[model samples]
Structures are given as C-alpha cells and as structure tokens.
Target: MGYLELALQKEKSLLCKRLGHKFKMASPIKTRKENRQVLYQCKICDQEAWLQWPEDSFNKLSENAEKSIA
Candidate 1:
C-alpha cells in the first residue's frame, strides 16, 4: 500500500486497539486543487477529521482519456 494508506491503517488500528473505536472515511470534498481533502469520522464516537493529500498531484482525467484512445 502507499505511504498515506499505510499511515491511515496504522492510525485506525491504534484507535481500535486503544479506544475500541472504528472509523469510516467520507467522500472527499471536491476542489480544483491537486491536493484533495477528505473527512474521516468515527462510527461509534464523536470524532471527525479532515485530511488532505500530502503532496500536489497532476490531474489524471486527460491522461486517462489519452491512454484509452491509444
């Protein structure tokens, strides 16, 4: 898994083990920026967080379309 995914898993594991809670990630809040923002909320607790990509990323829609036509 990617670094960010691994970190999120580790955080979830820690929360499950320490506080006996579980969380679910919500859909991202769309924006024009490369760094998309998402929210995670606990299923059984009053916890919520906003997370963003660690680095900027180029748009992929055009790239995917080009590849499909090739």
Candidate 2:
C-alpha cells in the first residue's frame, strides 16, 4: 500500500475501534467460487475482506439470526 493508503487505513482502524466497522456486501467474484465466498467492504476504510459464508461468523447478529432460523 502507498503512504496515503496506509494513513487512511490507520485512521479507519481508529474509527472502527471507536464505533465499529460499517461493512457492506461486495459483488461476487466469478473466479473464486470454490467455497461460496462472501466478500465484505468496509464503508469507512474502503477495504475488502473475504469470509466463507457457512463457516465464518460475520458478526454476532448474523450468528443469532442463523441460530433462530435453524
């Protein structure tokens, strides 16, 4: 990452620590379809992260929703 990107990341991290990350669902990647990957982008940082949909808990609310639905 460049200097500006690094600085932005640091600032976003601090903001996340204070208020938590505001994430949104990212578009699907056609190349990576091995395990039903789910991508999330942080609104504050504009960073991308991937997680396995069925295995990973995206957040506490998602976990709770799964439990209730199942």
Q: How many clashes show up in model 2?
A: 0
**1-70 in candidate 1: lDDT tens per residue?**
1222313464443243345565555433223344454455566765655555444332353344357668
Q: lDDT values of the candidates?
A: 0.45, 0.46
Superposed Cα deviation of residue 14, candidate 2 (Å): 16
Model 1, residue 2: C-alpha shift (Å): 26
Q: In candidate 2, which residue pairs clash?
A: none
Pick by lDDT: which candidate is best?
Answer: 2
Q: Which pairs of residues collide in candidate 1? A: none
Best by TM-score: 2
lDDT of 2 by residue, 1-70 (tens): 2222211254333223333565455543211346555556666767655545544433443555457668
TM-score of 2: 0.40
